[model samples]
Target: MRALFWLLSIFALAAGLAIVARYNDAYALFVWPPWRLHISLNLLAILSVGLFALLYMATRLVARALALPGAVAAFRAQQRKQRSIQALRDAQRFLVEGRYGRAHAQADAAYRANESPGLAALIAARASHAMREHVRCEEWLRRAAEHDREVRVARLMTEAEFAVADRRFDVAAERLDALRQGGHRHIAALRLSVQTAAARGMWGDVLRLARQLASHRAFTAEQAAPLVRRAHLESLRELEGNPEGMVRYWRQIPKPERNDRGLVRDAALLLNASGQGELAAEAIGDALDDNWDSALAELYGRIEGGTLIERIGQAERWLRAQPRDERLLLTLGRLCLQQQLWGKAQSYLEASLSVAPSRAAHLELARLAEQLDRNELALKHFRSAAELTG
Candidate 1:
């Protein structure tokens, strides 16, 4: 529509000029010093218009020629940027495809092209690590640190993980310490620290990190159970020489873990050895209350001191509920023996034998006979105990 308007305007102007030209005949004379020339005014106007059009075209051509170099530079820059983006994308794809060599190549190209240089370098480093090119991996990590300071957290995390993979626990620990000092204690970093600490046999750190992660719901109960249990077991061994330390640690363990039969058994044995019979008995009593195990009942009898009446009463109560449990009866007998109630001890041991003639029951009866100075009965019980292969 705009083109049509301009076209009509041009035609109208031409017709007006034609009518004017037709109505009047005009001429102009140009005189040079030596010659004189005559021309029409309309022709002079046409000549001036033609000269203006030629000059305009000439100026446009010159301007285009002068701007050509800058235009070409801008075009090349755009092309490089596109190539760099493609390289970075291809690198990520190759990394996911497990083509380490190709991923490293593409990432190197991206880095050289300066497209997200820090990210490119880290990608190359990961690929190198996968390929077992340790030197190259370290070099790329160094380049990553140099290229972008903002990626310090990422670089340190990567370095620490790779070091852990290599079993260079000390190096991994150092990297993690540096990361913590830099104040990047996100869940992922904490998880990595857990792995590193576990690898280095740093059970203390493992326990601390596991608890922290658990609070954040970072792992489910099923997933965290073994980790927490292992940490506790290791920590137990760590405090082997410090009985008070063991006591403090035991009390801090959650109630559910304290009810684990296996854990309670180990803990009881350790506590007994450390002269903490009361706590040991308490732990055993708590575990037995949760779940009955014959082995734990037997272990209960072996613990000698620490509120003997309480432990005896607890065992007798369990015996009331499980009258035929030989191990529980034997434990009752042992507890009676500890309190010097010879008649009760002998009676319980005999009842245990009547229920199930086990070697442990006979052995306890034999010990009771000796305590009461019945040599013939002690000899008979000893011979009976010798026949069983317990």
Candidate 2:
């Protein structure tokens, strides 16, 4: 529609000009060097318009010629940039595919092209590490650091992972420490630190990180259970033979962990081994009141050197709640025996044997019979215990 309008306007203007030229006679005369010349004003105006159009076309041609070199250079630069981007993408794909050699080559190409050089160098470093080219890996990491300061965290994390993989726990620990000091303690870093500590047998560190990871939801409660349990158990084991240290360590554990029956039981046993029998008995008594474990109840009776009356009272209270538990009866019998309550001890031990027929119960009854000077009863109980042991 616009083209039609322009065509019609041009025709109308031409018709009007033709009508004017035909009706009005206009002339122009010029002389130079004694020569006379004459031309119509319309012809002179037509020549002037044609000359302006030619000059405008010539100027445009000259401008285009002058700008050609820069345009060609821009096109070449665009091609190089595209190639660099493609190389970077290829490097990423190869890395994911586990094609370390190809990935390293592609990443090197990308780095040479200066396309995100830091990230490319990091990729190269990882590939080199995968291929066991330690020297090359270190060099690439150094280059990555030089190229981009923003990749410092990434560089350290990668190095720490490799250190862990190579069993260089000290190196991994150093790297993790640097990460923490630099405020780079993300979930990934925390996980790596946990693994490093575990590999180094740094149980205390492992326990600390496992708690942190659980709180951060890095792992579910079920998934983190074994790690938490093992770390805490191992840490307790390290405090063996030192009653003061064991007590201090137990006190230092979080209340929730300290309250765990398994932990409490182990801690108590360790305390018992360290000759803190009173403390050991106290720990077991508190745990039994909160939650009952048959094995733990049995362990409670083995603790000595505490107040016999108080311990007997504690066992009797538990018996009221668990009337039929054979282990509880056995524990009560042992505690009564320690207090020299022969009649009560014999009755409880016999009741335990009636309930479970355990060798331990029979043996305890045999000892009680011997204390009462009943050689015949003691011999009978010992024979029964031997049969049960068989």
List CA RMSD, all candidates. Answer: 5.6, 4.6
What are the clashing pairs of model 1?
A: none
Model 2: per-residue Cα lDDT over 1-390, one tens digit each: 999999999999999999898876788899897898889989988998999999999999999889999989999999999999999999999999999999999999999999999999999999999999999999999998896576888888988999999999899999999999999889999999999989889987888899899999997877667778778778768877777887777667676666677777777877888888898898788778878888889998989769999889889999999988999999999999999998899888888877889989988988988888988988998999899878
Give each model's whole-structure lDDT: 0.88, 0.88
Worst 10 residues of 1 by lDDT: 219-228
* Lowest lDDT 10-residue stretch of candidate 2: 250-259
lDDT for residue 243 in candidate 2, whole number 0-100: 72
Q: Evaluate residue 23 in candidate 1 and report its C-alpha lDDT on the 0 to 100 scale.
A: 75
Q: Candidate 1 — what's its lDDT? A: 0.88
What is the clash count of model 2? 0
